[model samples]
Target: MICFNIIQLFVILKLCSGMRYIDLKSNFISDGVEVQHGYFMTSGKYKMFHARDPALEVIQFGETRVFPDVDYTPGTHSLFVEQFKVGDEEALSIYVFRMSVTSNSVVYKVYFHMSEFGYKLIDCAKFTELIKGKIHVSLDLSKSKSHPFFNIHTKEEHGQSTTLIEIRKSIAGFRLRNVEAKRYEFGRIMDSSFPIYMGYSKLNMFLTKATSIFIHKEDNRKYIVLRHWTKNIRFDLMTVNGILAWNAITDPEPSLLEDMHQKVFRLRDRIDGYRALNPLSTLDLAENISPELLGIEKVTGRHGGSTYALYHLEIGKEAYNKIKFVVNSEMLDMLIAKIDDRTLYAKVEVITNSQRTFLIITCLMKIDLVYETVINYYDKPNMENTSYYHVPEPYQTKIVSDMYKKYPVLINMDIDNPPSIVDHGELQYDSYILKYFRIKQEDGRGSVLSGKYAFGDIWQKDLHEIGNIPYEGNKRRLKVIAHSVNSSRIIVKPKNMEYPLLPEELQDYVIIDG
Candidate 1:
């Protein structure tokens, strides 16, 4: 009995390692990890100090200020620790630490806040006096609907503020892939390697580590969004021994996955007035429609010249025409730039005001690649089918019968052997891609596996306009990002000299570090 208890404790300790500090950061939402902003730096707790361990002269501060250091340690793990010990008397430290990172470039946006007792201070006033108000400041700003900054805090920035972001070549980060107060407020995506390499063998290897596995179905393609709660999934790790014992504890087949996947994506409660848009009248809510941009032409009227964007949406044997009015040629240039080779399309809303009826580009429904690291993915299934659980897809739209095949459909296209974006447009670019990857050293560079595509080292980040004002394109939240930040400070840092098949249509992974 004694030996058994000791063994159990040992097992628990081993499992408890590698836990995350999830409670540190608030909701840092980014259209489902589609885009990432500049580095989030917090100097102080910015909250009510619950505990003050007198043993430590000062509290912890970093990306997650006052958050508990990982490993049950006391100090936060910033990318770099800045300090100045005046003399033999004592040490005064000022630091900026990044969130926890494993063996990969992706850093988890998580931190914990436990009482600090790591290092006791000899002179408390000296340390506290220099950095009291520096860490904590009153955020006078209101959480107004009109305010742009997601992080509403009032911590005063120090002189060395830019040193943290600028000193480093680049940094890759992820907030919780979540939605709050909106239609869906799920947890953060701990990892997207499952969706990144689902059909491949990657999902089988890393499924057990996922605390909650969700199947996100947009159109025909279903994406696996894996969420692992920090410290919660301790005992449920997928070690080598765990994998060996998987057969005894889990299902023997992929039936659960198949069943869950086959289940169609259903709509929950309608958030906006979209459902009540009166389908019988001039405006019909486009439930499940993919309209391709036919053409854009500039028309000169008696007053001035106006550009118009034409779209052809096929809805069950009938073609719904949509003409979008543009303000100027610059708008047309931006639209054409995004829709260069690939068919640029949007899900639109038709509106009429008794005089003229037109289409308001509602959204560009797009699924972009989010790069993540995975130990491996295999064919093992846990006992519970996670799909059957969670928020149910509430409302179901009536059948449109495949839009009665308006556009040409290539039925026999091979999804298994999808096109490889080695280089740009033509076949000659293959050599260029080969040259580029060889120079980058395919396996050595720590890029994501090339199973999905030839060179898979890319991520999709939503790049909105810099300030509070959102990206007001022809289509709202346009599915596009400039290669560089381009008059903005929100570019993703170097990705293992990273690569991401971005701008979905082009499959162009811009060169930053390499």
Candidate 2:
């Protein structure tokens, strides 16, 4: 009991004496690398310490040190420190700590810091994770483009990157996951999902891509008002003009901040609501958390009379069909004009709000697009047994010999080397398409008459519909005329050099691009 009292007294005095400064963790005396506490800089002071050693207190995430000296106000401070150990070189380090307090302890969290000239490669990480193990060694490949053991070459072709890794498994020094979430920003993006999220409890604002910082006089605190469009009214990171970072408390707006919190939780409620929904049986499941999304295409359209994105998302196993994604924030809707949606893998659930239901992406963790099957499908498919198209009917053998000359680009494809259309005949499955067909003949030189799917996505049969679709701001699209599936659906150009049929009403309309 007496020992406990002394320790308590010392802690109380440390807090009350206004000595709210932490001595930098000693280099050797501090706790060495342990998964949970490895990254936490140990607390201590040494005789070898320089005057600027106190600045190292800021090099933490989670709950920052309760240091009274290190200013959390906006602006960058450059500190140069000599080697922590004797006879070692110096380093330039600046670390940003995220704030989160647990049981009076400053929880060491994520970190992004600059080093002198080389990476401080540690074999172990500061946090616990099963997927990634840390790398112990450092490489000087930047100085000289050579590795003693491994040969790495990168090739870029047609907007795609391919890397050949021939290294032996004996190389335990190389990490399976080069980056982990608890240590940095990048690994999560590559291994997890995009729009990496981090929250700060010290202030009532979200900071990302900050622009300008403002310091208030009466409060003498750093305050940032961010404007975000990605979600939760994503506020663009607030930064100061000419200066990089600013941290201040929006102390005056307690009620306003509470209201904002209410709004944020409301979004969270919507997310939970989405997860409760039973996903489509047709869609591939994502470990039952949600339906998997194979890819994303951003569409600009009007929603509720206002401009927003109607995301055209690719569902599992189907490439041509699409599912729509709704936004969690109006701010994200506002950014519809600016967003450039990349082809990414995502998982989403359906939510019902305002008597309407839609799918929304709620992240657990996202993976990269799996395209091996797609690549192989193109290279290995037997075209004869698939849904294929070609020049339909009498146009298959007509005066259209000159059609190729008239529109070389339009008539291009494997026109002469046609594949026999698929005949399922009696095969049964979950689903199958009923399409028209004809057997291909290996007779003469390939010509525009021989049919194949390669020529183009749009055919002249769709010309009438395409020619009359309404312009922007109009929701109307083409409505194809009904026809029996047994009969082929193609129109001979000009009916022997004349015009094709159109809906009686649109006879006056003419296609502009055509």
Candidate 3:
């Protein structure tokens, strides 16, 4: 490919009382190779111009003309101006003349040489003749213009020197000496039976673009119409108060929720809602307990065998102040107790203003619990973990370092690994490891410890083993052991651990069975 950094070109148009100008800069790179030789038209009117190096002095003018009736032979022509000094006068001449075509098949001859003028007219007819059987001619008038300074300024004579007008034109002058014939063939036409326009509003101006659609036929007499366009389609239906603006399509708004609701109702006519009846008698007891008493108004219950239940508590607004103080104290206690772990993952949240405080609890299996903690920002928050026991700045580093020491296996995964839920025995976690390495840092007390560890693993061995495990072993196969630490916190630990019997050291290992 040939890269060309084109300088700016300006065209000034003058009207009766106003003037307008157009500025343009073009960049192009040509492969110097052709696929299906043809003629192409420029988007706007333009003329080709040539200039000498250094001073960019213009010396000649010409235009390119194509004769499509000629054979479709594709190639490139590179020509540059050669200049010289003519005894007290600056004389310009052609420097290089080269034409490259397919297969190294080229012919040439010198037609005329003006030795006194320091120029020669090379015969391009022989070269054109060779490709006459397979040439496609295209016209290019981009080079037909007077030089930049031509006729614009008065010429001044400086003792015994004569000025010459520089000409700028297309090099199609070669066409006058050589001729080739070619033809054109049209391609397949595009289908037009589809939505033609899409509209969007920004501030006040309405922007639109051409769109396409597809139609599909269904069973007996039904049909489906699909609109294919950019996903970011938004329209402002109305704007009021300069604060609330409703933006949506006027037609029926598409919604996955509505479709899911309809599907659920169609499955069973007697079902009122999608919730299963709570079998544990504590369902009503959960609602009676005040959020202040429980620390949080939420608790998880289990059928004690397999199934689990989540309880949510609601209180009136009158109890807000009392519950707020009590909940805060409980939260502080939970936070302090969690400080011993290398990394603390918990949620201490309270929704205020309502008369009644509400608490929500969700029951999670071991794998679900661990996976959520490692990947979920809400659980393993990025908040600064500082305390009066240590300097605030290095608290996060200390916690992360301690976490690695306690769970060294988790740090071995490369940082570049693809995003996914990975299960190793009782522990399930999501890791994004692309690169692997380790770093060490010291605390304010001067205790050196390894900090950051990143790595990537492409093998998906655990996924395959889990998929093939028998039902009998899988039933008793616990992935994790989860425990509720308090009203707002839960902790999960992997129960299975095993060492591979391989001779070489195991690069990465996951607990598969307890």
lDDT of 3 by residue, 1-514 (tens): 8543322111111122121111111111111211111111211111222322211111221111111112322222222222222233221222223343332121321222224443334344532332223111211112232222122122334322222221222233322122421111111111112111111111111111112212222232212222213322232323221212223342222331233223323322322221332111112222221232222233222211211222222323222211211111112121211111222212222111222222221221135245322211012222333211212334545534533553211212211232111222221233211222222332112223232222212222132112222111111222222131111111122233233332233233321222
Where is model 1 more than 4 Å wrong at Cα? 1-309, 313-354, 358-514
Residue 58 C-alpha lDDT in model 1: 21
Score each candidate by Cα lDDT: 0.23, 0.25, 0.22
**Local accuracy of candidate 2 as per-residue lDDT tens digits, 332-393:** 21110111133233333222234332233322222365322110000112223222122344
The candidates, ranked best first by TM-score, are 1, 2, 3
Residue-level lDDT tens digits of model 1 in 121-216: 334344444323222111111112210112322222432111100011122433222121011111112232211112101121222222233333
Evaluated at residue 479, the lDDT of candidate 3 is: 27
Give the TM-scores of the predictions, in the order they appear: 0.19, 0.16, 0.16
Model 2 residue 20 lDDT score: 23
Winning model by lDDT: 2
